[model samples]
Target: MALNYDKIVLFGDSITQYAYNVNVSPFCLGPALQDVYTRKFDVIQRGYGGYTSAHAKLMIDKIIAHENTPTSKVKLMTVFFGTNDSTGPSSTIQHVPLETYVANMRYIAEKCKAADIKVVFIGAGPFNAHQWWPTRPGNPHNRTTIQAREYCDALVALGKEIGVPTVPMWDLLMEAVGWKEGDPLYGLEELSAENPLTEYFVDGLHYNAKSYKIEYDGVMNAIKQAYPELLPENVPLRLPEWASLTSPDVLEKALQ
Candidate 1:
């Protein structure tokens, strides 16, 4: 298919916002943004902190209304949420009612389609109480592996119905680590000792640096796989050499 728009907007929660404030190589989605479209596409991070899909629906409409100029067009957009919804007291591991999650995603997909914007949906990643050590007894803050997997499956099914691409973020994370001891989600190695080993959030809700990298990488990989025509050849698939030269803490400071 031919390229659609000149701009790519990233829409989601804190995970999408990490790139604007962090330089931890993995946490940064700027590289991926540039890679997908070279200079032709500008990746704008429109993610809000602590937002669920319910909130993202508003953000999307607002962005479209604000930027709906004659020359403006959105080629692509990605939406990721559900962590917050899963953390609610009444929420089960299966998430804030699987039906509700599907409904929210469908709503987003419909609006994007109407605008002629390609939409990509990402499922929630795996969360293991056994892997993550920083959780309460009830695992109240985090969803279980079973729950995460089921939610992702539901999202994927929704993607099929809506005829949009669905990136399996949860599957990618599981393939990358899969409850491994040294995995950042639950790893306790000296390298990750200073930083918390929990999946993404300091409290199991929001994301930290490590989780940011994992999610960003997964999202980029998905974009490349599904929309290769939209990306430039010179753009890198991995972090640049310089990105690894700086210490994580120093990189974090620079972003501040």
Candidate 2:
């Protein structure tokens, strides 16, 4: 099959930017997918830390209006927001009102579509309040786990309305069997140890290194579903040993 586009754009909050990193080229999703797309495309990681969908709208507007050049060649733009709109002291501390959030995303979708660029909305991933967060609202160990997921669901709805493809990352993380019995998802310790440089979270809100891998895999799989031609040809199918430990059913259903 022929390739789709020549560049990929990633826009979101700190978590979208891997939560925390300065002057770093490969922030998170950008770097992880860079290697995978090396032969065919360039990944532009436009991850601004601590931004809500409202803020993201401003930046994306600029890129679409100014930075995007017909001659430069950009094929896709994957957007992942809503995390900051839900949590963090410094954040707006309020869920982005569904209407406003969807509008911002729509702005992005319309712009990219006009340019013939594919738009993929990556629903924010699931997070275990007990492990990933320092404290829950009432329960220190665990608060309601599905609120963020719910916001992600709204994003999915918005994407569908605009005819944009969505990566159901929330479902992927929610369905995963925890690394251990007590934890319903992988714990920080187990995740951080995946690699020496890996730290599951910088605070309780952003990805370190290990979690980035998990996030990247889900998005890539999602992209493959919507645009198979964009993926590297002749890539072998292989699963990490530990990944087999998760629910097989979810693993078997290829992301689309």
Candidate 3:
């Protein structure tokens, strides 16, 4: 039988889904990880656009079971949600109550814990309503920075309570654009075209290459600190390197 590699699962909504090819660049988190982990461990993406925490909880079992088997175990999992979960009621079909969001997140952590997998939470990723407002001019705004922060903060606190480390995507992006706490938000289309927020965001909602680099750095740093053993540099390739083979017999033996 072929060798089965260990797994690193990225579970979340559209952000996770889009990480591989956002803005037509593989510089995003998913591909960056796979590049580093090419022969060490497989990176499995479970991103679902429009998925809420409740949806994540429901899907966790399948995700875990898919990799956390006897042969190929899941060593790490990034639970990235809350962007869609932060949607206000009557705004999007994916919205879940804050309390429900907390409960669902907890459920996902518990599942990963039971499987002996290390979990990292990435949440409440930043959003710019002013930049996003044009998408739905007359309709109710589906999400805002404040609401996203509400859920992200809750998730951060939840991570603390659950003893899991969290990567603060929302805060990092906000700070990148120099957003100070207690700053008043502008109405739709209020920001100047030259606003710093325009640099990291595409259409005020999706991330471009620059912002994705932030995400890649955050994930690598989190792993470097919390689970150094899983770092790409530290992990050995499962199979022998082709250049290391001395003879045809050695190569055949290594394969066997």
On TM-score, the candidate that comes out on top is 3
TM value for model 3:
0.92
Worst lDDT run of 10 residues, candidate 2, spans: 189-198
Each model's lDDT: 0.62, 0.62, 0.82
Count clashes in each candidate, considering only residues at least 3 apart in sequence or on different chains.
3, 1, 0
Per-residue lDDT of candidate 3, residues 182-202 (tens digit) = 774432244453567767776
Clashing pairs in 3: none
lDDT of 1 by residue, 1-256 (tens): 1132356787877767665665443446655556556546667778766677777665677787665546667777887776555544455433356678778888888888888777778777655453444545554434555566677888888878767778776666656554444455432222243332254544433455665667666666666777766555633333224656567765555334
For residues 1-256, what per-residue lDDT tens digits would candidate 2 score against the true structure?
1232357778776666652343432355666677776655667777777677777777766776554665456777888887656543333444466567778888878878887777888776655443444444443332223556667888889877777778766565545433333543433333442322113445445565556666777677766777776676633333324556477655454321
Error of 2 at 206 (Å): 1.8
Alpha-carbon TM-score of each model against the true structure = 0.68, 0.67, 0.92
The lowest-lDDT stretch of 10 consecutive residues in candidate 3 is 184-193
In angstroms, give how far residue 40 of model 2 lies from its true place.
2.1
Clashing pairs in 2: 14-19
- Which runs in model 1 stand beyond 4 Å of their true positions? 1-5, 23-27, 88-95, 128-142, 178-217, 233-256
